[model samples]
Target: MPSLVAPLMSAGCLAGAPQPSLPVEGGLLLRPWRLADAAAVVRVFQDPDIQRWHLKRADTEAEAREWITRWQQGWQDEVAAHWTVVDADSDAVLGRVSLQSIILMGGQAEISYWTAPWARGAGVCSRAVTAVAGWALSEAGFHRLELGHSVVNPASCRVAVKAGFTQEGIRHNALLHTDGWHDMHLHACVR
Candidate 1:
């Protein structure tokens, strides 16, 4: 397999660490999701909230491995970047974030994030979101970042705002929710 560390730093997502991890506040660290994290990542998907807002089905260990493999490929292609949030003190997987669909015309990309059930409401997602967004703007050369949340997911909307994303507007039937198609609240942050 290709070295994941080199591509992440080359993508402008890290600096000077000679490693994949990005240190954040409150004893937390963010690094690229690896195949080894498949099982834990699948566990995060088991959270109903994660499935609901993320609009994805549950993942088996095999599927998680494949997913991480694809994430690595995306980094190689310069198409997207992914990170696994972990506790710096314990190295426990807490969640994930990806800066995807980067567009230079708009100089923007979409941010997707989720927290393990156990980590909710403790400011983990907020800090990770802010850290990644800051890196994207300051180092990754992105001019704006966007996020969309199902109208019913107030928690995600809260995270977006807490991370400095401004509520832009709502899109009718912008996303398919667990129940059915639903409107999405659009948010954006610009440099």
Candidate 2:
């Protein structure tokens, strides 16, 4: 039953490496989420666009802290890796980027992201995604990275393209949002 190639990436590849702070364009940095950012997280989840796409909301700072806690623990579990994108000078929260559905066995993971209202139109999401994907593919030893967004979200498609991911195809009814199911455009980059 075990007829297959060896793991494309070693087990514990992520757990063995500490999460790192990454730099992005426009003086932004991607760092591990902290509990102190609970308030900002709540603020972002309030945005209707985010709620629609991300399909979740943080109505309270306590809930936001729990989310942050999960992101922290995910590093050890090697299931997900989330980062808060912030301004390098003032450390203002600008957005988020994450590697989800991590499969060390395949040396691959999916990328996710969002931009704060204030940071929209400033390319924060694209830049952060690029930085994170670059690190995941090169330093983190992942062979491939994927980015998927609702086909309805053209802006997200733009972010993926700008981040150097190529559009591979679309999946019908692949994403479940709060409203209903949505088709998703799939994008990918290989190291």
Give the best candidate by TM-score.
2
TM-scores, all models, native as reference: 0.87, 0.96
Q: Whole-model lDDT for model 2 versus the true structure?
A: 0.92
**lDDT (tens digit, per residue) of candidate 1 on 1-191:** 66433322234343323325678899999988878898898898887777777756556999889889988776666667789999998889988888888654445789989889999989999899999999888866788889988888889999999999999999999777668999989999888
Clashes of 2: 0
Clashing pairs in 2: none
RMSD of each: 6.2, 1.2
Instruction: Return model 1's CA RMSD, one decimal.
Output: 6.2
User: Which residue window of length 10 is worst by lDDT in model 2?
Assistant: 3-12
State in Å the error of residue 48, model 2.
1.1
Clashing pairs in 1: none
